[model samples]
Target: MISALAHGYGEEAINIFNNMVRSSMKPYRITLVVVLNACSHSGLVQEGVRYFESMTRDHGIVRNQEHYACLIDLMGRAGCFDRLIKQLEKMPCELDGRLWNAILGVCRIHGNIELGRKAAEQLMELEPQSSAAYVLLSSIYAALVFKKKKKKKYICCSWKVGMGREGETTYGGDWRDR
Candidate 1:
């Protein structure tokens, strides 16, 4: 099932999981992680939430760091920033590099400089030697800068009194900002 998920076959992975349950096989913590990851990759936010809740509520499976990370990532990918931060705040385990990296990546996607910087700070303390956090933070800043510059227009005017001065104006920098 995990391999199916890793190969981008989310529906197949879920089918296998349902079969596992029907066969009276219990799911472990890693099973929840794999299923949640599949849901995340497949953009199944609601299903991921159900699986996350089931891990503790139904199966009595304790959520370790990886499981929490998966939940965070699922929420983050779905743009559930408020819920994601709330879950992060209520975490039983200390924030690890994986979780921070997930947060930073989402912040990058949303162009959230403030939260991205905070996430990077935490990541720096947790894994100072790694440059991932630094790069993500820089990316967020660069995104912000790009957005700001996107507002400034570059106008090209050609003399054409007959045509009411035919002119073309466009954003002059990287096309991504547009």
Candidate 2:
């Protein structure tokens, strides 16, 4: 199943999962993560939702943060932002960096500046020392600038400014503010 997913064969991975179920082999938590990830990467939104919805009922495996992340990623990659937002609101688990990161990624892909900024802010609060969120936010801003054919200059820089590991620095502002 992992090999199939790594090779971009999501259908094959799903087939393997079905075979495992038919053979009476109960899947582990990580197994569901991989399957959901496969569904996300392969654009199998319906299948992914089915598997996620059935995780606890059919397989007795409770959904966790990783599962929610995969489902969010799946929905976001499909440009189902409305549905994704609804799902996020109802998520049983607490929102974390992983979930926000998934949302940010989809926002970036869809050029949703509002939601992207929210996601980025949540990520920054959850993982302030990490530069990934800042970088992604800048990318979204860059996309917006290019889309509008704006001539204003934009600047983004992230680095550590002090001896403490927690002293991460990031500088960014909207070109429109210039």
> Which regions in candidate 1 have their CA more than 4 angstroms from the true location?
151-178
lDDT, candidate 1, at 90: 89
lDDT of 1 by residue, 53-153 (tens): 88888788988889888888888878899999899888889988998998998889888778888999999999999999999999888767767777433
The C-alpha lDDT values of all candidates are 0.83, 0.88
Backbone Cα, N, C clashes tallied per candidate: 0, 0
Best by lDDT: 2
lDDT by residue (45-138, candidate 2, tens digit) is 9999999999999999999899999999999999999999999989989999999999999888888889999999999999999998899989
- Using alpha carbons, what is the TM-score of model 1? 0.78
